[model samples]
Target: MSPTTRASRRRRPAAVTIHDVAARAGVSVATVSRVLNRKTPVREETSRQVLEVARSLRYVPNVAARSLSIRRSHTIGIVLPEVHGDFFSEVIRGIDLAARRAGYHILVSGSHSDRNEMLEVLAAMRGRVDGLIVMSPDVALSALHDQLADQLPLVLLNSVAEGHTAITIDNYGGAHAMMRHLGTLGHSRIAFIKGPDRNADASERLRGYRHAMRQIGGRAADLEVPGEFSEESGYAAAGSILARHERPTAIFAANDAMAVGVLSAVAAQGLNVPADMAVVGFDDIPIARYLAPPLTTVKVDIAELGRRSFEAVIDRIDRGLPDQPRHECIPTSLVVRQSCGAATSLRRTKKASGKKKTTRQEEI
Candidate 1:
C-alpha cells in the first residue's frame, strides 16, 4: 500500500492509434488516413506496409468518428424481395464487389412481399446509407415513387419506378425470344409457366409470351399454368400441363428456379426433356448449364445488373449529381441448349424423314 508501489502498479491503455500505425510504417498520419479511407491514391508498397503495421498493432479504424466528421457513413443500403436465392445472391455479390472497391459497406434487408415492411426497412436506413438499391416485386412504381422519392439517392432494380433512377432487365423481350426459339423447334403446343402475380417482371414476361404466340400464327396451346416463381410451383404447374387432354410439345417457365422444378417433375413422370417435352427458362442461373439436359434460357447478366445499380448510386453520391431520376433497361438474349431442342437439328431430322411440315394450330 506504499505510495511508490501504487504508482508503479498504475495501468496504461494498449489501444493502437493511427499515429502508431503511421510511425511504424514510416508514413505520414495523412497517408495512413488516406490508405484506410481509400479516399485518395497511395503508393502501392506504402499502402501495403501501412496496412501490415496496422494489422500488427491491431489498429481498428473509428468508423463512428469518421462518420461524424464526414457526415457520411460510406455505406449503402439494399432492399430486396428475398435474399436466399441465386438471383439475389449474385446481385449482392456484385454490389459487394463495387462497394468494397469504393470503400463502402452494405446493409441489406428483404421486404418479404410487404409494402409496410419495405417502408420500415427504408426508415431504418434513413440516415445510415449514402444511397439505396431496392428490388420490389410487390410494390407498385407509383407507391415507391410516392414513398421513397426525395428520401435518398435511390436505384430501382428489376422494377421500374417513374421519376427514379432505375435499372430493369428486358423480361418482355427475353420471353418473346424464348417463344420464338420454341416455335422454330416446331413446338406448336407450347405451355407457359407463369410467375408470381405480384411481380411486374412476371406480367411483362407473360405479355411477351402471348405476343410471340400471336406472331407465330400457330395453334399455340392456350395453356397457362399458375406459378409463384418457386420450384414447387413449377413442379405443380408441370403436373397441370401434363394432365391436360393434349400435352404441350414444350414448356417455358418464367424463371430458372421454376424451370428446375418442371425438370424434376418431368423426370418423375419418366419423361425425357426435348423429346417428351422441350423445356426452356429465363434468367440463365448457374445451375442451368449443369442440368440433366442443360437448360435453354434467356441470359440476363444478373451480377452485372447489381454492379451497375451500385455504381449508379455511387455516381449520384460522389459526383454531387442532380436528383433527376434516370432509367436504364438491360437487354436479354436467348441461349440455345439441348432442353429446347436444337432448331437446326430438328429441321434436319424432319427433312430426312420426308415428313411434311404441318401447319401450326392457333391456340393462344
Candidate 2:
C-alpha cells in the first residue's frame, strides 16, 4: 500500500519459467521439455504431477526455445500507427483471431505516429519475430524498401508501399465511388475533410475525391479542407467552412471519425445532415452504423484486410514471397444510407451504383 511497497512490487522478478517447473517437480529439464512439447508420452499420473507443479509455480514455457526447435516463432510482430481508432483495433482483432487459430501469438508495437518510432519498431523486431505487419506507416517508404522485402516477410496493411506484401482496400475506387454517390443524390457542391497529408492511405483517398469531382466535370479546386482523421479536427475545421460563407451542400471525410465530427459540428450550428449538409465518410467503423441516421460511408472489409495481411507475411516468411500471389486486394464500396442525401433506407446500403455484389472481390 505504501510507496516503497508499490515500487518493490513493480520491481518483482519476472514470471516463473520452465526451469522453475522442473525444479519444483524434482524432474530433469529434458523431461519437463518433453512433457510440455509432447515429444514423448509420460505416465499419465507423472504428467499430471508435473503440470500441477507448473501451474502452482505459474511456470510458462520459453517461447524462444520452442521457436528454435520448430524453426518458427509461431509468433508474429504487428506494428500499428496508434491504438486510438476502431480501424486499427478491428484489423488487429481479426489478425489475432486468425493467428491464434494458426498456432501463433502476436507481439504488437505502437509507433505513436512518428517516423523515428517506426524505424525503432522495425529495428526492434528484426530478429525476435518471424514476420512483420505494419499499417499506414509514418516512416519513409525508401527506408523500408530493401530491408522490408528481403530481411523479413512483411505485410503492408491499409497502406501501399512497394516491395512488401500488401492488403489494402480500394482507396481510390472507394472515394471516387462515394463522391459519385453523393452526386447521384443531387449533391453537387461537396466539400472534403482530408486525412493526414503524408499518410499514403489518406493521400490515396484525397486523390480519389479530386478525381471523382473532375469526373463530375468541375475543376474540384478548393474542394478540400485541411483535416486529420480525428473527430476533433473535423469539428474544428467545420467552423472555418461554416464561417467562410461558402458552405457546400455535402461533405466527405476521409474516415468515419472525421465524418462523425463533421456531423456534430454542423448540428451545433443548427444545420442538418443530408437535408442541410450531407456527409459521407470512408472506412465504416462500427459507430457509423449506430449514429442517428446511420452514416452512408464506404465499407472496407477490415477483417479480411487483417487476415490476408497476416497470412501474406507468414507465407512470405515460411516460403519465400510467391510469384503466384503478389498482393491481396480488399474491395470497398459506397454504403448508401440516410446521411448522404439518400432516403432513410438501410435496405439500399450495399449499392450506390444501382448494382448488387456479383463477384467475391466486390463483397470482400
Best by lDDT, which number? Answer: 1
lDDT of 1 by residue, 1-364 (tens): 3222333234675356677777778878799999987877898998899888998889997777778888888999999988879999889999999899998999999988688888888889888998999999778757555557765788989887667788888888879878877877787778999988879889989999888888876554467888999999999999989888878889999999999999999999999997899998999898898998888888887888899999999988987757677887777767776788774232211223333221111110
1-364 in candidate 2: lDDT tens per residue? Answer: 3222322345556566666677778887788877777888787887888888987877777677777887777778998988646878888888998899888889888888776777788788777788888885456667655456556677777776555567877888888888877777787778888888887788888898998888787557777788888899999877777776767888888888988888899899998776888888888888787886678888887887888888787787777656443676677766776788676533433344444421111111
Computed on alpha carbons, the lDDT of every model, listed in order, comes to 0.82, 0.76
List candidate 2 stretches off by more than 4 Å. Answer: 1-61, 146-150, 321-325, 346-364
Off by over 4 Å in 1: 1-60, 144-147, 218-221, 321-323, 343-364
Give every collision pair in model 2: none
lDDT of 1: 0.82
TM-score of each: 0.80, 0.79
